[model samples]
Target: MKGVVVGGVSSGVGKTVATLATIRALDEAGYAVQPAKAGPDFIDPSHHEAIAGRPSRTLDLWLEGSEGMARNYARGEGDICVVEGVMGLYDGDGSSTAMVAEALDLPVVLVVDAKAGMESVAATAYGFREYAETIGREVDVAGVIAQRAHGGRHEQGIRDALPDDLDYFGRIPPSSDLEIPDRHLGLEMGAEAALPHEALSAAADHLDTERLVDVAREPPQVDPEPAGARTDATVAVASDAAFCFRYPATIGRLHERSTVQTFSPVAGDPVPECDGVYLPGGYPELHAEALASADTLTELGERAGEGLPVFGECGGLMAMSQSLSTTEGERYAMAGILPADVEMCDRYQALNHVDLEATSETLTARAGESIRGHEFHYSKASVDADARFAFETVRGDGIDGDHDGLLEHESLGTYAHVHAASGAFDRFVDRLR
Candidate 1:
């Protein structure tokens, strides 16, 4: 396997579009292309799956352990693999995409938003490559993709500023057809969401796909012993357009320890008979009415009342509330697992990272244990005194008084989305087993 990791100087620099386009082109060229995202993002990976015809796995060095990162990269059994960087090349709390690249020893293809100042772009690229070096690994700046170039000035400025070692791979001129729609959580995905096939096709046509693929190291083999005998534990995962904020690695990890079952809250499906249930974040607000009226909510409430271990994050947290009030002030009854009334707020709540301390034992977590996760949502949860379970604390700057994560009875909810590879995640899941 050989490939190039595509990263932007910052967000909105067309890295996702360029990455998807590159993957599409490689797939078209008969190369087995596997796509990976750097952080704990679900939407971009969903879009990558749309283009690459494969599920995009996440490789967050902060969330997933170094061994997990290496294992994921090595699992990219393709002629070419494209790893898309999150926020920025070196933008992460403890570890970042640059660290992942270093761990895998892969080359990087920097994507610059050329609409901005071009004269300083070279310095930015140089800084990123240097940052990679300081972390004990040499990084090759294979080339740069100048995005949103207009009037050729941006490209020319970038080319002029580049040092002799770096190459200007290609440019993608601005086009109205290329814009991806966004919401509070991020990009929306469904059968109806726009796929941007033409835009990706055009971007792929301009990049040097052959050269980029030549640098990707081969993926490693994961021959973990078959999962041990199935445990009595079962987790109910919500799977639908509205509730799809789950990492494949999380599910993989869960299955490694016990049997896992999936159910959709949108379709009014019954929660599978299981020891526990997990509702990862998604767009429950968008489908507030349907979910509110769904019979599944009543059933989940019934199950939770029976003391089954239940957990929700972000949208899932919202879904498990007593009521959900949308931005329009429309209210809908929810699972009522927690005595919390969740109301939609005008502003978005996007907590990127936090230090999580377990205040109570709900899932596989023990009291006083600490972990790290990210939280992003817009729902404000107001709970009654009786249902509150204070099991976690945020050590860093967090939303709403720097206290993040929520606990209610046997149910756990939080905006902080932890990756499966995190030690906290391992401990949490171990308790579930």
Candidate 2:
């Protein structure tokens, strides 16, 4: 599919709103739109999926090497793909939006906040376009989308001020309806706080849909790889608001290799009979009360003790711990399978692309194997001194400063959320067998 990157001049530059409006405009124009995110973020893609009615592709170079990243993009289905960028265009160290655009060879439509100046907006867009060259980056800032720009004089001034090279796509007018409410993690999940369709349609009407379609171009084609060997092993994945941070590609990989079943632990469903269990990262802290009393966790603890392989990441790590303490000072008993206590912090405890080398054989990787992933959470774990760990932190913070992957029984939990492209899921499935 042909694609274009919607990049912000900076964080809070309304890139999400602009991208949603662009997706709306494209969909209304009768194109099948595939939404994607340019970083290791789960929240913004929630909004993108809600609007586009499809799972947003996770495109990260750190988590997935260049070939893997391309494969993830290749798996997406649509006539056009709208990749919403992370932070500023060039702000990230591990996997910047500029790098993603350059790798895909896709044109970028810079989202310039036009809440203040007009000519200055064009100047900023020009600078962003030329700055890539200065940094030896081959990013094509093809045009500008005037975020929160007004019509008539304001929009015209932004459009007229643009140099002949930079195209003027359109603007997202300022509106309370255009705002998505956010909390600690990011914006509330799209299901809880989606922008009104009428509001999105109104915003879409102002955009140059034809021009955007013209600007969108195809990336280099990747030869499809043959399907891997399959297994009869069943994998039960936790699915609910509390455990919603799983990547679509992760589930897709599991489904391709084994029988996949899902149950809601937040709703108190008992754990399903399966060869293994996978609890993905999410907001288990928000539902600590419910999870504390969940039969799924109870049975999961029992099964884990009985040698059932279980793997948890981030929030999953918190849920699988001995206890969880909320920011409000309420402590709840957790699954008690892992020898650690988790505490929610007032601010994010750690957020970065992470690399881990297995200090010993674990559920996801073997001894001496390295796993690449990312961590973004608001909680910390107080692990027992005698607790066993599987991996040594090669980069970023883990459960403690030096280690990650708390190991107990046949289960392992970590703060790092790995993508299927990294071969972590493959090892996970193999271990399940």
Candidate 3:
């Protein structure tokens, strides 16, 4: 599919709104739009999926290697793909928007905040483009999207100020209706706080859909990975608001090898009968009270004790722990399968691309195997004195400063969220067999 990167000059520059408007514009212009995200972000992609009506491709170089990221992009289905960048074009330690754009060889439509100044917005866009070469990165900052810009003189000034090389794609006018509500994790899930369709459509009307379509280009071709061999084992995945921070590709990977079933713990559903269970990350703390009264985690604890392979990540880790103490000082009992008490903090405890080496064989990796993932959470886990950890932290702060992957009775919980490209899910499926 032909694609273009919608990058920002900096964070909070209305990139998500611009990208959503761009998607709406493309869809209105009779094109199938595929949305994708640049970093290891789940929230932004949720908004993308809401607008594009498809799962947004995750294109992080750290979680998934260059080849893996390319393959992920190759899997996207659409005539035109709009990738929303993370932070800024050059920002990020492990993976940046520039890296993803360069890897895909896609031209970037820089989103410049033109709310205040038009000439300065053009100058900022030009500086970002020129700064690419200074950093020895081959990023094509092809044009600028004047975000929160006005009509007449304001839009004209931005257009006139652009250099010969930079194109003026269009402008996203200032609108209070375009704003998405924010919380600790970032913007609330798109399903909860998605902008009104009328407002989004109005914003879309301002974008230059023709210019965007013309500038979009396809990334390099990649050999798609063969589907995993199917197994009889059924894997039950937790899929409610509490456990919603899962990558679409992770579920796809699981489905390739097993019968995937989803149940909501927040709504008091019991865990399904399955050989294995997968609990992803999300706002478990927010629903801790409901979870405490739910029977799902209790049943999961019993099943886990019976040698059923269970893996939980981040919020899943919290849900699988002994207890969860919310920031409000309320404590609730969790699954008690892992020997830890999780407490929600005002500030994020760990936020980075993670590298882990399995010190002992676990559901996701064999002994001594390295795994790449991402961790961004606000809870801290206090483990038992004799708690058994399966993995050693190599590049991030795990549960402790040095270790992660709390293991007990064939169940494993970790703060890091692993991608299917890391071979972790494949290993989990193999263990289920």
Compared with the true structure, all predictions reach lDDT values of 0.74, 0.93, 0.92
Q: In model 1, which regions exceed 4 Å deviation?
A: 115-124, 130-139, 150-162, 190-194, 218-229, 396-405, 423-433
Judging by lDDT against the true structure, name the best candidate.
Answer: 2
What tens-digit string does per-residue lDDT give for candidate 2 at 80-129? Answer: 99999999999988999999999999999999999899999989999999
- List residue ranges in candidate 3 displaced over 4 A: none
Please, what are the lDDT tens digits per residue for candidate 1 over residues 1-433?
6667898888778888778777877877788888888877888988888787777878876666677676666655666778898888777766666767766667788988777668777887888777766766566666687777654566677888888888777777677777778887667662446567777777667666666666556444454433434555666778886778888777777777677888888998988988778888888888998897789988998888888777887788888888999999899999988778888887875556567776766564577877777666677777676555544455543334445556655777776777765654455556667
lDDT of residue 263 for candidate 2? 93
81: Cα error in model 2, Å: 0.4
Root-mean-square deviation of every model: 3.2, 0.7, 0.8
* Residues 1-433, model 3: lDDT tens digits: 9999999988999999999999999999999999999998899988988888999989999999999999999988989989999998899879999999999999999999887997798789889999989988999998999998999999999899999899998888889999999989889998888878788899888888998888889888988888889999899999989999989889999998899999999998988888999999999988999999989889899888888888999999999999999989999999999999999999988889999999998999999999999889999999999999999999999999899999999999999999999999999999988
Provide TM-scores for the models: 0.88, 0.99, 0.99
The per-candidate count of clashes, in order, stands at 14, 0, 0
Candidate 2 accuracy as TM-score: 0.99
Q: Positional deviation of 140 in candidate 3, in angstroms?
A: 0.4
